[model samples]
Target: MPSQNEPAEPLAKGIIPTAKQQFHDLFVWKQRVVITNEYGETRTEWVTPEPLQNPISLFMQLSLKGWLYFLVGLAAWTADAFDFHALSIQTYKLADHFDTTKTNISTAITLTLLLRSVGAAIFGLLGDRFGRKWPMIANMLVLGLLQIATIYCATFSQFLAVRSLFGLFMGGVYGNAIAMALENCPVAARGLMSGILQQGYALGYVLAACANLGVGGETETWKTVFWIAAGISIGVGLVRVLFPESKQFRQKADVDESVHTVSAKMFLEEARLMLTREWKMSVYCIILMTWFNYYSHTSQDSYTTFMLTQKQMPNDAASRASILMKTGACVGGTIIGYLSQWVGRRRAIVVSALMSGFLIPAWILPRSERALSATGFFMQFFVQGAWGIVPIHLNELSPPAFRSVFPGVTYQLGNMISSPSAQIVNAVAESHFVTRGGERVEAYGPTMAVATAIIALGIMVTAALGPERRGSRFELARRAGDRVEVGKDVEDVVMDAEKPATVQREKMDEIEKK
Candidate 1:
């Protein structure tokens, strides 16, 4: 340890931020600057940000290839969301078809959530070790087959079994999708792209609700939504076959070839080293994801049932309200995600969480279709607005070599921990009663309100205390002796070389003197 009179050494990479530092970072906008040493090696340092760039200009910075990668990743994620929400939104129909209680039907959801961690572990490692393309293609194709299998289930047990299998495949999509989507994105464009990308979930929900609306309220019509979901998943998989592996992955492979052949032993050694270094970050991310999973599932899964039972809305009205709700989510996620670039990620998340928490009373109190639709829209806007920052936030924090596994495993493990959220809500709502118009009803409104409030508070606190690495470089590769270099590809190094050299000599001189 340094003497009290001397300044302390800088914290190692991935060290947790102090509360004071976290608070400062919440409001600070650091500019990413490159510093080249005498030996012609470069590393990034964060200082005061320069003048803000136009959002349009930031978007224009992406090459055509970058846009294609982002779009394909978004499509895969949207299809995955559509497949999962198809079941959640149609829970009542499935229960009636199976001649089972709503809680029992929700068991399928619980099983699906519980098993997703396994898929994440398997596929995330596959994505990190192999190329992202084949693992994602396999995940999407298998998910489509599972969706069709779900439609053919003759028994509730079979339905549960199929959904469990579905969960396993579903867990793999998020890691690869976001990794491929944002890995090549310019630092300035990341927040905007991340926002747009995360909204694929809301868009999927909207599409599923629209399908449910079109097919009408008949018990058997849920099959049509499942079919549509299956088509979308299969279509995305087929489309992915046309694209080459992500440029970053290809570059990494080339660099690895020079150092040593890419093999299982090398991959495992890297993974073990990463875990030893980053276990704390991994644990923190998992906790954050657990709160987020609970926040979304508890507020959303049984909302249609809540409207039908407690608010006395018809199926069509409830479906419309749900569609409007997710539409708000799509809009909010995009807008807030964009604003996070300027306002800072954690501040954006904390503010959105608090705002959504405040809106809970209005969210649950509305009875009429128009009233409920309006409130639901605003509620989801803030709820998912906070969520909009998640994709890029996780990507920024991830270790460069294991981006796929780190985010995916943390997210799915969180999903595993919070798997029973919907079931818990259902059981509690059914067991407890609330009075509406002098009649008793399942207490979904109160249940959701209380749960959402607690979750919102949790998000605010967790995010406020967490560390951020908002513009860390991703175009990295390992050199000899496992030293990671900032630019791997020839083109990238050339680009950096062309930029003006304004090295922060004072900082370097100070470090040398110490």
Candidate 2:
């Protein structure tokens, strides 16, 4: 592979057919390079980086890449468990598998919940280190097996261990998937991309709920869902084998690693540099927004079915409510989320997060079950809408080389903050709020709303303080006006063009295949 340490020089991959010149739009606006040809001039007139001759061409470049990775991200995030409703109905049977008290079996679920953060950070690092393509593939296979392994465990300890391990693999699926989505999309498309990416979590619940309803939890084949999980993971893994490595990762790996001696000290130094006093504020904003996102999915979503049952709704009805919540989430994440791009991500986050404050308080309404479900749908659509920006917003804040670390850490940190809250809240609700014949309302519902509102405040704060990267990064920091900032070894860490490299250089072929 050739060393491309130069800022303005071009290198061609099959997608990026020619090396893009070191052109900097120093004007700090949203437009591509366009040079017009004049007919009557004796000397050809030269115009500096004006807007593109055709902007849609750039759109195509941006869209095609973003869309491809988004599809992959969807598959990676599609395994969320919504069978908590079913589990409640079939608690006795599930307890039998653990060979312990039902409470103990119930407690083991914490293992699965906590470990996913661990997986996200671990696999996220691998995505940055080796490449996004292979770790993702391997993670799928492992996660599938772990899901299947969930079925045959003879002891609660065994089940907990397997779930924790499964979470580790699933973590990779998400953290890397987010990194992949950012590398592929244009800056303009990021908010939408993040919104779309967040929808995958809701979609996973839909899949799990449908399966739970179909299986009905009574058959020996309730374990069949794991089979489905396994099959999909394996299938997706195969497809990802042919998936393109980001031109960015390949470029860096071909030359030298962006990071040397991946130690805590070096990591801190790099983090300090990235999170300058100004960037520190941005990091906090990322943390706050991420806090809501992490809690909403893990704590709130996980407990909805439990809450429905507690409220005296039938199992089927409760399951339907959870499904509807996710349905609302999918729609909200995809369509209404456009506000982030228009209002600016900061205002969009504040407005959307504040909606959680209103909707969550509604859960306390004295109302019919149907009315409660409607409010659930409303809360998910808007409160969760704020979360959709996280995927894109966080990525934009991170420089390329530290991409995997920051996203992974934020995601896990959010999970860590929220998961225990889910448990503690569950315990508190059980102790104090028992109603309807002393059967506590599902622990996830009311507590989740409260949890999310507090976290939403954090998100709002982050948005106010974080760096805004609305246009080309090169121009935003004036890095292009002077020189690219990466060290010779670090330059390749994030040099992706919105298109594939087409020159088909034999360089890095084996590295790519491996």
Each model's lDDT comes to 0.83, 0.55
TM-score of model 2 vs. true structure: 0.71
lDDT for residue 83 in candidate 2, whole number 0-100: 26
In model 2, state the lDDT of residue 256. 41
- Per-prediction count of colliding residue pairs? 0, 18
Please list the residue runs of candidate 1 whose C-alpha ends up more than 4 Å from where it truly belongs after superposition. 1-17, 27-46, 50-52, 251-260, 477-514
Question: Per-residue lDDT for 127-161 in model 2, tens only?
Answer: 65556888888888777677678788766677778
Q: Which lDDT value does model 1 have at 70? A: 92
lDDT of 1 by residue, 26-71 (tens): 6655633445555566555556644457778988988999999899
For this target, which candidate reaches the highest lDDT against the unseen true structure? Answer: 1
What overall lDDT, based on C-alpha atoms, would model 1 receive against the true structure?
0.83
- Of candidate 1, the 10-residue stretch with the lowest lDDT total is 1-10
